[model samples]
Structures are given as C-alpha cells and as structure tokens.
Target: MITTTMSASERFELSSYRIPGSDSCFYIPEFITEGEEAYLIRKVAPGFRPALGPSIYERLQIRDSPVQRWKQLANRRLQLWGGELTSNNVLVAQPMPSFVETYPDIINRLQQTGVFHGSPHGKPNHIIMSLVPSTDPSQTRADDSPGTKFVPCLLCVVDIFLTVEVCVCVRVRSMSQAKTVPPRSSSTPSMSNRQLQPHEDGPAYHPAVATISLNSHCVFHYYRYTLPESHGGRSIDPTPVLSLLLEPRSVVISTDSLYSNRLHSYVPPFQARLGMPDQRARRIHEIKEDRFTAGGAADFVSPIANWERVTDAATREVLANGGALTRGTRYSLTCRDVGKVAQLKSFVKR
Candidate 1:
C-alpha cells in the first residue's frame, strides 16, 4: 500500500528535494499513484483492433502506423493540442483537451506549487505529446527544434522502460527568429508546420520546468553551454554539471538558471566506463567525432548531481549498476502556457 506522511503543502516545497550545485531544480519520487500512471498510459497507447488489413504486406504497413494522429519525426512522433503557436510565439485562444486540462492530481499539485504563478496564463495552455519508439543507441538523434525553447514546461512520461540521458545547453542565447506555423485544423491538427527555431531573446513563456516520470526509471543529465573559440572565443564545459535519477512516479522541477541557462536532452543508450580515468578517456575519444561533439556524449561515469536526493533504493541500485539500459516505448506529455494568445475569430479572418 502507498502511504505518505508529509502534508500536501510540504510535498510541493522546493527545499524538499532540490538538487545541489544547480541554480534551481528539485525532485520528488512517487509523485503520482500507480492507478493514475496506468490511466495515462492507456490514454496514450494505441487501442487494439480485431481485424487485420487486406493482405500480409498491408497488415505490416498498417501496424507501422501505430497512431494515425502522430506527426512522424526521424526518431519520434509528436501530437500537439490547443493549436500551434504563431510566428511571434503566440497561441490561438482555444480550449485544451479535457484530458489535459483536467489531469486532476498533477494539475492540482502544480497549482499549489506555484510553478506557473507568473505566466501570462495562470496555468498551462498548450501540450505537446511525443511518442518515442524503442531506438538503437547508435540510431538515436538529438531534438534541436525550436519547440524546445518553450521553457518552463511540465513533462510527464508514461511507459518508459530504459534510462533516458538528457543533455541541456544553459547560459547560451539564441539569435534565430524562426516562425511558428499553426496546424491546418486545431482539434485534429497535422504536423505539416511543426518546425520551431530558437528565439532571439528567450522563450516567450515562463521559466519553470516540471517533469513527472511514470512506469520507468531514467537518469537526467545537465550540461553547461559553451561556444567554440573559432565562433566567438567563448569556450563551453564538456562535462555534465549535474545528473539526477528519476524513478517511476517521480517529479522533477527546474527553473530560473536551470531553465534559462541550460539546454537538456536525453542521453542515448551506451555502456559507460566505470572508472573516472577510463570514462574521461572514452569521452575524449567520442568527442573527437563530429556528431558526438555537435550533440554531446552519450555515456559518462561522473557522479549524479543529485544522487543523495533520490530516496528510492531500486533506482539507486540501478545507477550503481552503471551500464547500458534496455530501451522501451515512451510517451511524454509536455504542457506549457503560451504567453501570446489571439482570439479564434481574429485568427480565422486572417
């Protein structure tokens, strides 16, 4: 049986499980119950069908398209709700799906935590659903799209099976002003115009990111951004500043410096060198490769930045094991409050 002794207010406090050596970040294990996680997985998963397609080849092809609504990416698929943002990072005024708006337990706790207190909208008005299939470590790619600039998002993961290593760029400013094109239809929108570029100043949204992990455990890595001397004479630190273990039903909150200063991405599956000398040597070898340098290292053995904060013994054991983890089908629902919103009527006339 699940049980907790802390008060609701205390549970959301930043001091409870904040990570060290970082401007602002926190972790909470078992933030949601098993029942809620199961419900969310059911909603995200494709439903079973009794009949097969006309022919064997057709059936195989049909199976490839797990969900019709997903916008296919090279490594993953995505679905957006409440319409895509405009060129100026503006969102059209529309109601989010009931499932998103009314995700009771999490929404209530987030509201209490004041994660979105200063945003233009009091709560999250946008949601991005990412469907990542099991991918080989060598085949996995980085998501450097402009959509990542939408900061202060709440990421909820369901059905995760492997450790996801994320690399983030902090303290670097983006100069690009790529436009955000809205989908053709709001409700059943297509991914035709989903490209996003970095913002000149920063994201038009707030600066807090909250993540909830469900059904799996993963390691979160944080890195500081640096520029090549040839570009502007500025140098970036290649080593990860912090790493945290995210267990099933856990929540992680990052804001301020952690949000604005760093770019975070999941680490691909690769075996780590157990000792520091061997690990550093391996990293140096990998860094020589253009792809590894451009993206970041996929494996490392440095101590997790927030290791002591994790209370789950199982997660600690996994981290202690220190090796390549098996991959699994994962679904992430990222919620954000778009600062700019226009009336639907005005959008239609345009």
Candidate 2:
C-alpha cells in the first residue's frame, strides 16, 4: 500500500546527495523555498503575530504553557508534540501540530522519501522540537543596548542536538539580536554560550535521522561514534571524521550505519575562531576540530565535505576568510515512529 501524500517528482531519491565515502548520509540544498522557510519560522518564533492587538498573546502563551507549548531546559528550550514518554519510555500518544503536518506539510513529504519504510507504524508518530541558543544573554551588542534596534535571524542553531528517524530543524535562539552585528562581546575574548558536545539520539529512540536547516548557514560535524561512558566506550575524540556545511533551507538525511555509527554537532561561534592568531574569540560551543586546522587558520570551507556544494558567493567567501557565519537561533522538528503509545484513558486506568 502507498502512504505518501506527495507525488514522485516532488519526492527525491535519498542516494543522489549521499556524502562521498559515507554509507547513508545525504544532503539536499534548498529543500524548501525561501517563502516556505519564512512561513515555518513565523510559526515557531515567539514574536510572530498576524494581528497587532494580540502581540503579547504569543509571548505569554509560550511563557505560560511550558508543559504543552514549550519546555524550558538548562541549556535550551523545546516543544514536544505527539506526547512525552512515561518512565518506561512509552509515549502517551498525542497528535502532532496541525501546522507541521499541513501548510508546509513536512510529515507527508518525509513519508514520501521512504525514510521511515520499516518503522513500527511506517511513519513518525512523535516529534521532538529543539532550540539551541547561540548567544549569551549577558553579552551586550551595539544594537541590543537600551532603545537600540535589533532584529534576530530566526533560524540558526550553533549548538543543536539534531537527531531522529526523520529530523527537521528551524533555529535555536535565546534573546532576539540582529544578524548585522558582530558576535556580542563584553570581554576582549568571548566565550561560547555553551560547549559543543558530540552525541547521538541515545537510547530514547532508534532509527535513521534527517534534518532540515531553516535559516542561516553553518558547518556541522560528524565523528566516529563512541560507546557511552556506562558501556566503557572510549571517550569521544573531539576531532571530526568529516565536516559538512549546512546552508539555509537545506535537508540532510542519515540512515543505516551512518545514523547509528556517527556522532554529530554544529560549530560554535567561538570555537570556529579560537586559535586564529589575530582572532579574539576564545571559546565557542563544545568539541574540537584541531585535527585539520593549524592555529584555527580560517579554513572553514576546506574542512567541510560539502563545502563545494555551497552556492552563494558571499557565504563561500566568508567561509574562506576564516570568519564564521552568524548562527542565529535555530529550531528543529524530529519525527519518529514511537515504539509504544497509550491513550489517555489507557493511562488513567494504569
């Protein structure tokens, strides 16, 4: 039986964009149009409003509805759709947001790609939304001082945990800030909002993973997977096996051994510039790329496996200049065919 809403031409074969020498990792640039990308951003961000009088409504809704709308974390904030799991790791069963399934219709298109062909339900029933903030709130920028103008780039994730059977991401943002300003600096040398930690989805779920970048461009790293500490696996080597440039509106899917055997992370604002002789950035995100770089000389483009695939001249030039691009807030939608789910009634009886 056929289960996809999109036609064949609209669906892409995953193998065509496979990374060289990799088993099942694929990258498709500009998977969604700019207009479509804008639409998705408006839905996830707190500042968006279709009407003027209700400006405060969305901010309040997000702030107040922590259990349903957004969950605050020590490192970041995220939303959960479908349902949260029980202590046993079984999902409670909730429907995904209508906007995610319709309008842009992300779920249906993903189904068409055959990315979830053999899962329990043959489609994702749960979605994990993640937000990784790129900037520290204490840092003051020229545009962010009292009464200054600051417009943030809504879809950039510098330290994002993007994983799932089918992962779709937007941007991770903390405070709203403009893209035009340089990295916010209070100290002569800046530290990252957080360290970049390389990891997988872990025991929470099992399956292939896919991601779509909604806004901004940055380098994503994949490393040889290390067994967990509990398993006495070797401690993670911060050096990357491969680095790929993730552009806005692009899609990357990892299946089979690639999803399970590799650890992935995005470059941070500071780490990308840490060792440059003239650069002042001291620390950014987690992990290291010291294997291929010498004193972190600006070779961002050369280290990435898909650097040549980048189409924009300005972006290409910036990567070559040893300067990291603006990693605005980024959001992600990770879909998985949860193993077990129970209705509210079923749970009540338990």
Per-residue CA lDDT of model 1 for 56-153, tens digit only, reads 11111112222224466744566666666777877766655555445533555665667778877766666666654433332222122233231211
- Compared with the true structure, model 2 gives a TM-score of 0.67
lDDT (Cα, 0-100) at 159 in candidate 1: 24
TM per candidate: 0.65, 0.67
Cα lDDT over the full model 1: 0.50
Q: Assess each prediction's global lDDT (C-alpha) against the native.
A: 0.50, 0.57
Candidate 1 total steric clashes: 19
lDDT over C-alpha atoms for residue 336 of model 2? 67
Candidate 2 C-alpha error for residue 113, in Å:
1.4
Residue-wise C-alpha lDDT for candidate 2, range 1-350, written one tens digit per residue: 11222332386666766777676877777666777778776766645432222212222222222236557654446688788888887888876667667767777767777888887777677877665544534322233333444444323222223321211111212335523435445443222244345667655555766677765555677778455778676666555666677777776777777677777766544445322222333323343544323224233332556655566677667655665565655556666677777877786887
On the 0 to 100 scale, the lDDT of residue 82 in model 2 is 81
